[model samples]
Target chain A: MARKTTQTRKAVVTIAAWLIGIVIFFPILWTILMSFKSEGDAIKAPLAMLSSPWTLESYGEVQARSNYALHFWNSVVLSLGSTLLALLIAIPAAWAMAFVPGKRTKDLLMWMLSTKMMPAVGVLVPMYLMFRDLGLLDSRIGLVGVLTLINLPIVIWMLYTYFKEIPGEILEASRMDGASLRSEILYVLTPMAVPGIASTMLLNIILAWNEAFWTLQLTTSKAAPLTQFIASYSSPEGLFYAKLSAASTMAIAPILILGWFSQKQLVRGLTFGAVK
Target chain B: MATEHSRTAARLMVSPAVILLFLWMIVPLGMTIYFSFLRYNLLNPGMETFAGFDNYYYFLTNAAFWDALINTVTLVVGVLVITVFGGIALALLLDQPFWGQGIVRVLVIAPFFVMPTVSALVWKNMFMNPVNGVFAHIAKSLGLQPFDFLSQAPLASIILIVAWSWLPFATLILLTALQSLDREQQEAAEMDGASVLARFWYLTVPHLTRSITVVVLIQTIFLLSVFAEILVTTNGGPGTASTNIPYLVYAQSLLNFDVGGGSAGGIVAVILANIVAFFLMRMIGKNLDA
Candidate 1:
């Protein structure tokens, strides 16, 4: 009898969870649904909008109406470019701090995390002026550089956490086994830390891809990512729900997939391992 | 394990990241402080001169400054309240033995993945538009007037969108923390005839306190600089209703070219954010030691 009651309770809990989940997921689901509807039908009453005959006209219109491909390419380049650069700089530092004992290592990690706390606007003036004077404005290189700098602290901290987890005995054992220092690190440490590095890379890419502040302020036309392309919809023809949905869906689709994979890493990275 | 050669090598490996981050933080910040003391405007180049405290005076005295300050606080606090509470509720629900738990988790975290600009645009035009939006369609079908969400309640609408994006984050973190709770202890408490409320209040709430603090502080730091949602939605309008410190700085320097005023504003914002960061750094620093 008790087992039956527990099973019934589980069923009740499942129904409630699904209902809330669907409501929360409705907006994204609706956006996807709206993308498949006719423009006129998208703005119709909610039930009708959902039940209406679906079509792919808006997706084609989205491509035809704007420079969607260019913005998409910019997003891909900036996100991947910045993430790779940050990892290159962070890996060595994280390795040294993680494996090596130093007096200022903790202080250094804390200080780096503090830098992440500094509000972006606090230096927007100088950064903007520097970019303008250096003729780096509206260039992909400029955006990539800025994204790398902003995300560097996060990259370092995430890596440091992951690196710290690795037992020093492993490295010590390898060294005692007559492995050279270079090969021990290259062959042993690198292989062990690959999961950490990959997850860090994934989270960083999501951050850079969705970054709106620098991307919006720094770029005008030549290097504006999908953020800008989507914002442009606001002033001109944002009212076209079908095309707008199509653009938004496309713009967010790649990152959404990327973000899902990094959910566990995200909690760890963003919280700086506080909860974990 | 201890060798002079490796110690030197470690330092060499770490120098590049440290130096670059130091320069990135200090250089622009140093310039901003210096510019805050000057009467500089990008509109009229080469007319810069020392004007100590004058920019600060102007920025402090400006009515818009106060509005932006209040709006910034409101946005941060508003989003925190919604997301934190909503997060707890959702996390609790998801923690139950539910069918399709994996799919539900994926669905719940979806909004966080949507780019800020895309989410902002979608909500503004498609969900919140007065006449042609989904909300309007619902209202009209229910025999009611379509409410103009942005114009009527600009800050609230932006807060809603921001909360939606951040809710997943709060849920994910709290759920992570929740998952670590001792199942045996909870089962024991239940066997002792403790009511659900008592167990939840004494056991679950205490367990989540650290994660909740983490969520609140991290969200505050990001929430203080909420720019894109405001930019794309109300543009800090119906007149400064949704303007936060970041948007104000962006406007003063980039839009209006008031370098002095903007830098002063930026300095003020830095001071405000540091107050929160001080506590947060300490919290995470404690975790690092553990």
Candidate 2:
């Protein structure tokens, strides 16, 4: 009797869960569907819109109208460049803090995390003036630099948590076997840290890719990322739902795939490993 | 692990990150403080005279400042309330025994990854636009008027859109927290014939308290600085109806060219965020010790 009741309950739960899930995901699914429709049909009643004939005109027009390739390249450069630069700076710092105990390590980690909380507007005036004077405005290098700085603490924190979980004895064992300092890290620690590093990389890429605040404020035409490019459609251009959907679909698709895979790391990273 | 040579090496390795972060924090912050007291404007760039407290006085006294403050708080609290409650409900359902759970979970969590510009723009144009949006079509089919969401209830509309983007985040974190619960305890309670509501209220809710607090704290940090949504949707329109401190600061400094006033507003925003940051740091700090 208990087994039969549980089976019924499970069936009921499945339908309810799927229903809610589709409802929550409907906007995105709608956008994708509308991307394939003409402007007139795209904005029609929901059932009519879904049943309309599909076309590739909007996608083609989006590419022809805007420099979509340039923005795509800018996004790739900023997210990847910043994540790689952050990794280079963060690994050693995380290594030292993880293996070498210091009295101020915890406090230092907390202080760095606090910097992430500092409202960017608090310094927007100076940063803007600084960017203007340095001729860094709307330049990929400037965007990369700022993104790297903003995300550095998070990269370090994620690495430190991962490294801390590793036993120090292994590192010490490699050192005692006459391994040079460079080789110890290159061979011993690097292999063990790969998973953590990959997860950190994945999470940060999504973050950097979707980071709207700084990217929106800092860049204009020359170095505008996909975020800014999509935002440009918020004007009258966005009224053409088909083209808007096509552009948005392109901007968010790659990161959405990456974001799905990084769900586990995201929990660990964003919460500062508090929940985990 | 205690050799002086290695300790020196460690310091050398860590110094680059430390030095860079320090410079990043101090330089701009120092300049913002310095600028707050001067009569500065971008357009009238010249030798600036000092104006102690006037920028603060004007910014503090302005009607728009108060409205922005209220709107900012409303935006934060409104989104928090919706997401936290909705997240708990969704998390509970997702935790249940079900078929096709993986696909449903993926579908539910998809929005968090959509870039803000895309989500805000899509919601504004595709879902909420009165003339041709889906909602209008729905209303018209029912023989009702097409309602203009952004203009009529700009702040509330933003709150809904922002909440949609954030619900996945809250659900994922809370679900992760839920999965860590000891099933043996739950089964034992079930054997004791505890009612479902009683079980949830007494056992599950208590267990989720820490995770919920973490969600609230983290979400508060991001919500306070919501910019792109407003920039895209309303541009803080209908006469400062949706303008938050971030938007106001951008307007003053960039649009109005009043650097000193903008700096003052920026400092106030920092102070407001720091108050929340203090509590959040304490919470995480305790977790680290545990």
Candidate 3:
């Protein structure tokens, strides 16, 4: 009787959980569905909207209408560019702080994390004015610099946590083997650190990809990423539901996949390893 | 582990990042403070004079400032309440053994990956549009009036959208903490005849309190600066109804060209965020030793 009741309860719980999950996911699913329908059919009653014949017209129209490929390429460049730059600067710093037990390392790490808290709006005016003065406004290189700075702190923190887990004995062993410091890091450390570094890169890419505030404020038509590309749909002429859905779907699909892969690192990264 | 040679090399390796971050933090922030003191306007650049805090006076005394402040707090508090509580419920449900748990977790977490612009636009046009939205269709089919969600309840609608995006984050974090919970203790309590609710109240809530605090502080920091959602949806709209500090500052500086006034507003935002950051740093700092 007890086992039967437990089985029944599990079934009930599964149904309830699945129902709630679908409800939560319904908007994204709906957008994907709407992207397949024609513009006129997209805004129909929910059931009617879903039953309409699917089409690839909107996807083709999105690309034709707005040079979707350019924006997609821009997103790829900005996110990948920024993450790579941040990784270059952060790896050494995170390595030093993780391995070198200095008196101020804790304070230094905290200070770096504190920099992430300084709201982007707090510096918007000067950044805009400076970017304008430098002719950096709406330039991909300029936005990459800004994205790199903002995300650098997070990359360092995540790497620091990951690097902290690497045993010190290995480095000591390499040193005793008459390996130079350069070779020690190149051989002994790089292999062990690759997974952590990869995870950090993944999480940072998702962050920079979806980053809206600076990306929206900094870029215009020439350098706009998908975030800015999607925002263009807010205008009246861009209100076709099907096209908007198509653009949004394309904009988010890559990051959504990347995000799923980085779920474990996200908790560690965002929480500064506090939870994990 | 520390040799003098390595210490030097470590310092060298770290200097580039430190120097860049230092400049990044100081230069723009200094200019904002300097600009706030002058009667500057982008429309008439290089024709500025000292304002003697008049900009701050006007920005603070203005009716819009108070409204933005209130809206900012409400948005943060409202979203925190929903995501935290809703996250707790979802985490508890997912913590149970069930069929297709992985798929359900993925489905629930999908919204967080959708960019803010995409999520806000989708919710605004598809789900909340009164005339042709899913909600309107449902309402009409049920013999009720279709509700204009954005115009009638702009801030609340925004709160709902923001909460949906963040709920996954809170759930994922809390679920992680929940999984770490000692199963032996839970079963021991069960054997002791403790009610399910009692066991949860005593064991689970206590274990989750640290993560809950982390979630609240971190989310509060991000929520205070919500911009794109407001920008894309209502544009802080129906007359500043949804304007928070960031949007208000953006409008003041970028839209209105009142650089001095906007800088003042920006300084105020910095101070406000600093207060929250102070507490959050302490929390994360406490965890550092462990």
Best by lDDT: 3
Listed models, DockQ each: 0.82, 0.82, 0.83
lDDT of 1: 0.91
For each candidate in turn, the interface RMSD (Å) is 1.1, 1.2, 1.0
Question: Candidate 3, after superposition: displacement of residue B26 in Å?
Answer: 0.4
Off-target runs (Cα >4 Å) in candidate 2 are A175-180
Give, for candidate 1 chain A, the lowest lDDT window spanning 10 residues.
A232-241
> What does candidate 1's lDDT look like per residue over B159-250, in tens digits?
99999999999999999989999999999999999999999999999999999999999999999889999888888898888788899889
Restricted to chain B, the TM-score per model reads 0.99, 0.98, 0.99
Candidates ranked, most accurate by lDDT first = 3, 2, 1
* Best-matching candidate per TM-score: 3
Q: What value does the lDDT take at residue A125 in candidate 1?
A: 95
Q: Model 1: residues >4 Å from true position, as ranges?
A: A236-238
Model 2 chain A scores worst on lDDT over the 10 consecutive residues at A232-241
RMSD of 2: 1.2
Q: What share of the true interface contacts does candidate 3 keep?
A: 0.80
Question: What is the per-residue lDDT of model 2 for residues B1-290, given as tens digits with 9 covering 90 to 100?
Answer: 56898889889889999999999999999999999999999988996889999999999999999999999999999999999999999999999999998899999999999999999998998889998888998899999999999999999999999999999999999999999888999999999999999889988999999999999999999999999999999999989999999999999998998999999999999999999999999999888741
In candidate 3, the residue pairs with backbone N, CA or C atoms under 3 Å apart (3 or more residues apart, or in different chains) clash, namely none
TM-score of each candidate? 0.98, 0.98, 0.99
Note the clash tally of each candidate: 0, 0, 0
Best prediction by DockQ? 3
